[model samples]
Target: MPLWWHLMKSVPSLQIVLHRIAWSAVIVGAFLFWRDGRGWLKRALSKPNTWWMLALSGVLIGFNWGLYIWAVNAGHVVESSLGYFINPLLNVLLGVVFLRERLGRVQWMSVAIATLGVAWLTFRFGQLPWIALALAASFALYGLIRKLAAVDSIDGLGVEGAYLFLPVVAMLVWSETHGQGGFFDGYGVAMSVMLVVSGALTALPLVGFAYAVRRVPLSIIGLLQYVAPTMQFLIGVFVFHEAFDRDRAVGFAFIWIALAIFAIDGALRARRANARAPLVPAASPR
Candidate 1:
């Protein structure tokens, strides 16, 4: 229940995600350039194995983003919001299934509670939370593959972008030539900004995430990584005007309770270890 302190406040969700992706692309791509420049470019271009794995991860991430943006924009904010709430649990599941990570009793209980919350939400809503599940599963599998491949985050992303960008470029050019395309024109400054910066923004948190993964234990980062999704959820409820029905309220309450238990368990475990880490607060604005 770490207090979701307002952080990184920005534009609308669509713009935020879009701009973040763009910024990450430029920043990370430049980092790759400085780190190895032409040699890195050559290596990335020449390495089919690298691109092969990266291609799959890229597609998964792209699909996740597209679905997520569409969900938010198409008045499915609740579903998109649910996806983020489910993400941490999905990550834990991935760790358990793929990395053979062990779960503590409390952790297992947390997962169980979370699962029940999802099921209850689904039953009450009378439909599977497909968007949430898709977002969670896609992102979880993407992380698993990235870790398993052990590829350089930025460079690997550049390769992924190259793979995606080529076909996109062709389509863009073709449409424009045939007078059917509006990219880079319809949105004026917005399109210009996105065209140049989308890749960099998409790439930054990843670089931070990569650096964080190496510097901190997986367990620690996993806990910290909750910040982003929690932020996304708030945006959904407050900024996006998503209604909270009784079922949503109940489901979210259960999820919050599970988070509380998980947080307490983590705190207790940390205390037993005599760790000096600052305790995360338990209050998040509703």
Candidate 2:
């Protein structure tokens, strides 16, 4: 996805974002209609509170997407990767503060270590890593909103798409009519296809994430989630050749250590809990 975004660097971030939202709505709407018919969507939208929550979450995810597209295209992929690396720890902190959940000593220590990493990055860079921080904060908050909203993942996603679909489509139409659109403004057919496919690329991971969240333990998912940022980090350093000198490496090392601590601690706890209780069936996707 980052690679695709990087390839579309010439396109405005807002333009790409609008295409993403518009096409995702079309794709998800089609899927929903196929899976459960129109009645399902009507039922999902009937809950006024859920609709509002989806609206709020839509804004958050939209902001995250826009910032991420801009960051990747602006050659800040490493910094953006740092954001995801920091996100799990931020999720833990958010849970503690907002969900009133308690963290173990290990969890607190990990959070502290991650904070130190961010602090060091800020100190060395001579400015706050605002890109990383913003991405992490926005995504973490989006997760929180999704967690609190009592709806299926697909339903919530569909709702979010619906909320932004028409306005975004309108914006795209206006942009194209005004000769400022990137979609067909001499970018070639390949670029146009890529732009449309971005929606499916965006929606598939989310749907898979929702499926996994239902069936897999949160601890396991937490561990698996690292694969993405790890790949992004590698792509940034090796593929894009972004600057990652020793100083930045040191900061990333601190966060990596913190993540190791966090992952290990969570794994041990999950192991103990499973040992103490009989296994329950995983939740159905529906």
**What are the clash counts of all predictions, listed in order?**
15, 0
Estimate, for each residue in 98-146, the C-alpha lDDT of model 2 and write its tens digit: 9999998988999999999999999998998999999999999999988
Candidate 1 per-residue C-alpha lDDT over 1-286 given as tens digits, one digit per residue, 9 for 90 to 100 = 0011112122233333444344444566678889887676667556446657778887888778767765666666666667776777778788998899998988889889988888898899898888889998998888787777666766677766656665555655676577654445654665545544545545666777767778886557657766766776677677767787787888877777777788778767777776766678999999
lDDT to native, each model: 0.68, 0.90
- Reference-based TM-score of each model: 0.76, 0.94
lDDT of 1 at 257: 77
Superposed Cα deviation of residue 61, candidate 2 (Å): 0.4
Error of 2 at 205 (Å): 1.9
